[model samples]
Target: MLWKYLLGFYMLLVTAAAFLYAPPALGLGELSRIIFFHVPVAWVGCLAYLVSMLNSIAFLRKQKLEYDRRAAFNAEIGLVFTILATVTGAIFSRYTWGEYWSWEPRQTSIFVLLLIYGAYFVLRSAIEDEEKRARLASVYSILAFISVPFLVFIIPRIYSHLHPNPIINPGKQMEMDARMFRVFLASLAGFTGIYAWFHNLHSRYLKLKAKFEEAEKHA
Candidate 1:
C-alpha cells in the first residue's frame, strides 16, 4: 500500500520532469517532449510481449494452465499498451507530419504487430476446450513473439522513414543532452514500475477468479 503511494508520487515527479526538466529537441520544439512518454510506453509494451512469450514457453514445457493464464494476461496487457503507443504516436504525427497517419514504415510495422496479437485473442475465442485453447494459444504466442523484434525494431530501420532516431541506438553514441537523457531514463523506469504493479494486481485477480470458478464447479 505504501509502495503504491510512493509509485504514484514518483510518477508525478517523472511527469513534471518530462515537461519542465527536459529541453526540447533541436528542431522539434515542444513536441519533442512526447518522446519521454511515447518511448517508455512502447518499451513497456515490448517487455510485456517478451514476458508473455517466456510464460508461453514455460506452459509448453510444464503443461501448466497457470503459466498459460499468465501468458494470456501479459499478452492482453501488451496489446493495450501497444494500442496506447500507437495512439500517442499518431498524435505526435498529427502535429509533426501534417497528418494523423502516413503509413510510414514505423506505423505500418506497429499496425502489423497489433493485427498479429489481435489474432491471438481471436484464436483463443475460437477454441472451446480449455487445454486445447491453452496449448494452441501458447504455441501461437511463442510464434507471434518471433516477429515482435522485427516489426518493432528491424523493419522500421530497414526502410526509409521519418521517425526520429532512437535515443539509445546501439550503433551510435547518444547525442541527447545529459539532463534530457536523465529524465528519459527516469520516465522509462517509472513506466516499467507501473507495469510491474499492474501485472501483480492482475495476477492476483486471476488467482481469485480461478478459485471462485473452482469452488462453483465443485459446489
Candidate 2:
C-alpha cells in the first residue's frame, strides 16, 4: 500500500514537472518539449544497466537464484528503456539533424546494444537447465556491462563523426544554466524512482511465481 502511494506520488510529480519545467529547459518554446521523455528514457536505460551489473556480480559471487532473477529483471527493464531511448533519439534526430535514420556512430552503438540484449533474452530462453541458465546469463550480463561504456562513450569519442562531445572535458570548467540543470536532474530522479518501483514489483512477482510452482510440485 505504501509502495502504491509512493508510485502514484512519483508519477504525479513526473507528469507535473514534464509539463511545467521541460519547455524552458530545452529553450525551444514548445517544440523542445520532448526532452521530458527523451532524457528520462536515456537516463533510465543507464540506471537499469547499472542495476543489472550489480546484480550480476551478486549472482556470480553468491550463486543465488534470487540474484539471477534480479539480474534478469534489470536486463529486461534496461532493454525496454533502451528501446524508448532509441525511438526518442530518432525523433530528436529527425527534428534537429534533418534525418531520421543516420548511420551516426552514436545511433549505431545504440542499435548494437539493442541487438546484444535482444540476443541475451534469446540465449536465456534457449537454455533449459536452471543452473546453466543462471551461469550463462550472469556471464553475459557482466560482459555486456563491461562493453557498454566502450559502446556508448569511448567509441564515439575515438571516432567521432557528428555526435556532440561531452560538455565537461578533462580539467575544463563547465556551467549549465540553473533551470536546465534542475529540469534534467528532476527527470533523472523521476525515471529512477519509476525503475525502482517496477524492479521491486518484478522481483516480488518472480518470487511469488516460484513459490507457487514449488507448492504445486510438492502437492
Candidates' C-alpha lDDT: 0.88, 0.77
lDDT score, candidate 2: 0.77
Cα lDDT tens digits, model 1, 115-176, are: 87799899999999989999999999888778666676766666668888768889889878
Error of 1 at 212 (Å): 3.4
Which ranges of candidate 2 are over 4 A from the true structure?
22-29, 152-154, 158-176
What TM-score fits each model? Answer: 0.92, 0.83
C-alpha RMSD by candidate, in order: 2.0, 2.8
Runs in model 1 with CA error above 4 Å? 149-158, 214-219
TM-score of 2: 0.83
C-alpha lDDT (0 to 100) for residue 155 of candidate 1:
69
Task: List, residue by residue over 105-134, the lDDT tens digit for candidate 2.
Answer: 877877877887788899899999988899
Pairs that clash in candidate 2: none
